[model samples]
Target: MVEIKFNGQRYAYWQQVHISASVDDLAASVTLAVTRPGTGQRLGVDANTVIEVLIEGTVVTTIRPDSIRRHVDANSHSIDIEARSLGRELIDCQYSQTLSGLSLDEIVKRLCSTFNVPVQVTAKAAVVPDFSLQCESPANALINAARAANLLLYATPDGGLLLTEPSSAAPVATLVYGEHIESYTVVDEYKLRYSDYLVKGYDYRNDLALKGAVKDSGITFFRPLHIMADKTGQGVGGCDRRATTERNRRQARANRIDLEVVGWTHAGGVWDINSQVRVIIPDEDIDGVYLIGDRAFTLDDQRGSMTRLSVMKREAFLGDPAPGKAKRGAKHKAKSQDERLIYATDLE
Candidate 1:
C-alpha cells in the first residue's frame, strides 16, 4: 500500500510532473505529463509505474507486476499498443464487474439506436476521466459517450467531482484537478485598456515614462511606501496580470497594487500581450518573494485602428515640493529669481 507519484500530488489543467509508485510487488518510476481534458495540460507521469488498484471505494487490491501498459513510439513512426495483459490475464474473467445503474451493453445499444454510432465496447476497469458526474441522469446518453473507454473522472479545481465509490482511500474513483496543476502556464491573456478614461493618448505615455523613470531611479526608496492609484494615470487592477516587457518596470508595490471591483476601459483600444508565465521562482537572495518568469511584449488592441494604449517611462521621482519656492508663473507678476526660473520655463 506504499506509493509515490509526484509524491502522490495532483495538479490542475496540464502539469508536467514526475510520479513513481510501488504497489503490491510492482515498482516503477517514469516521466510522463498530466494532460488536460480537451487539448489538456500535459502533466508528467510515469506510465511504467504499477499503481495499486482500488475496487469500489477501497484500496484492497494490489495491481499485479505486469498490470501496466508501457511503450515508446517507434524510432520514427508510431507504435500502437496492442491489447496486452496487465497483472494476470483474465483467462475466464476471474472477477465479474457489474456497473450498477449502468450497463455498457445497454449504453452501446442506445448509442447505436439513437446516434447510429456503434461505440466499440471494450469492457474494462477504470482508466481515465470522461464526464461531468453532477450532470443529471437524463444526460446519460450524451454523457456516457463523452466518457473515456476506461471511465476516469476529472474535476475542476473549484468544482469537486464525485467518485463512483466516495469512500476509497487511494484516489477513489475520482481525481480532483486544480492549481495543483502538473505545471503552471500562461496560455493567453488580454490587457484591458482604460483608454476611455485616458486624459490624452500621448499624454498617457508621457506620464508613464516619467513615473517609470522615477521608479527606476536607483536611489534607495524607503521601505513600504504607500502610493495612491490616483494621479499615477494607472487604472486600479489594470496593472496586475498584463503581459510585461523584459525592460524594467516597477512591480506594483505590495501596498500599491489595487484590486478595485469596478474600473474603466477603452471603448475600442484594447491590448493583448501573449506571453509565457512560469508558476513562481524564488529570488536566491530573498527568502519569501519570487521573481515571476512572465515573458511579455506590447500588442495593440485595435490591430487595424490607428489608436493605441499609451505607455510612458519617467525618471526621477517627483516628490517633495520646493520649500520656499514662489508659486509658479509669479515672476512677471511679483516674484523672485527662483520663481522666474521655475514657473517660466517648461510652463506646460
Candidate 2:
C-alpha cells in the first residue's frame, strides 16, 4: 500500500499517487491527487511543507513541494501536488570555487554541505591533485567528479547524498514475464552507438594536449564520436578513461528492457535503483541479470498500483562492454545483428 504523511498526520482519500526515482539522477519525485477532505483536514500543504512517502510501512523517500494545484467546483474539490527530493537544491544552486588536492569523496561532501545536504561516500575514489570550479552548478561539479572516478552519486531515501558503486552482490529478485512483470518493452537502437570514440583534452599544468580513443566493435560501418574533454578529463590518461566510459554508457543504454510490474514492493522492500535483478523473457530470448537504473511507482483508479522499471546490463557501470544476446533478425555476414555488437572494446 502507498501512504503520504506530513506534519505527523497521514493523508487519506488520495485518488492517485505517482513517484519516480533513478540511480543516475539526484532527485526523486512525487505527484499526488487528493480527493475531497473533510473540514479541518485540508492538509495545509505548501511549498514549505515536507512530505514523507511510505510503501508497505517502509519509508521510500521524502519530498518538498515544488508545485501544488487546487481545484474546486460547485460539486467537487480536489488538490494536485508535485514534489521532489532535497537534492534539488544542488541542481538549482550555483557556486564558484577552485578546489585543489581533494579526493572525489571530499569534493562531493563539501559541495553538498553548502546546501545543508548530508552525504555518504561508500565507494573508493582517488585523490586528485587539483580541482576547480567557476560559476558552476554544484550538481554538475559533483556529477563530473563522480563520473570521472567511475562512481555513482544519487540521493538517499532520507534526501541525503550517497556516493557509491553499483551493487556487486546477489540478485535481489528473479522477475519472470507473465508472473511478476505485467508488461515489457525491448529497446534496441543502434544509432546511439559509434564505431570509434575519440576524447581530446588539454593538460594546462603541463601545457600539453591529451587524447584518448576507444571503439565499439559492434558497428560494422564507420561511425565516430568526438568529444572535447572537460576539466575533469585533464589528468594522466583521463581522456582515454573518459572515452571508454562514454562508450560503455552508450552501449548499455542502446539496448534495455522496460518492465511494468504489479506492485511497488518486492520481496525485500520497495523497488530500488542500482540493485540487480534477474529478468527472464522467454519469447525475446532475454535471460540475464540487469541493474535497475530507473523506476517509477504509480497508483490510480485505472491501474490500481504498478511499478515501471528501466534496466540495463550491469557491466555498463563497470567500465566494461555488455554484449547483448542475439536477437532474431537478418544476418550480418556470419554473425547476427546482436552478436556483432560487443562492449566498449577494440576487438575484431
**In terms of TM-score, which candidate is strongest?**
2
The worst-scoring run of ten residues by lDDT in candidate 2 lies at 339-348
Query: Residue by residue across 157-274, what tens digits does model 2's lDDT show?
Result: 7877899988777888999999999999998988889999886555445444556788899997899998766665343126666777778878878888999999898888888998
CA lDDT of each prediction against the hidden true structure: 0.20, 0.75
Per-residue lDDT tens digits of candidate 1, residues 1-348? 112223365223212222222111111122222222232222233444323322122232222232223333333221111111122221112221212234433433342334222233323322211111221221222222222121212121111111121111221011011321122222211121111111110112222211111222232343222211111112211111011110122222111111111111122211111111122212212112212111111112222111111111111011111111111211133234422211000000
Model 2, residue 195: distance off in Å is 2.1
- How close is every model to the real structure, measured as TM-score? 0.15, 0.87
Give candidate 1's TM-score.
0.15
Candidate 1 — which residues are off by over 4 angstroms? 1-215, 219-348
Error of 1 at 119 (Å): 36
Error of model 1, residue 342, in angstroms: 33
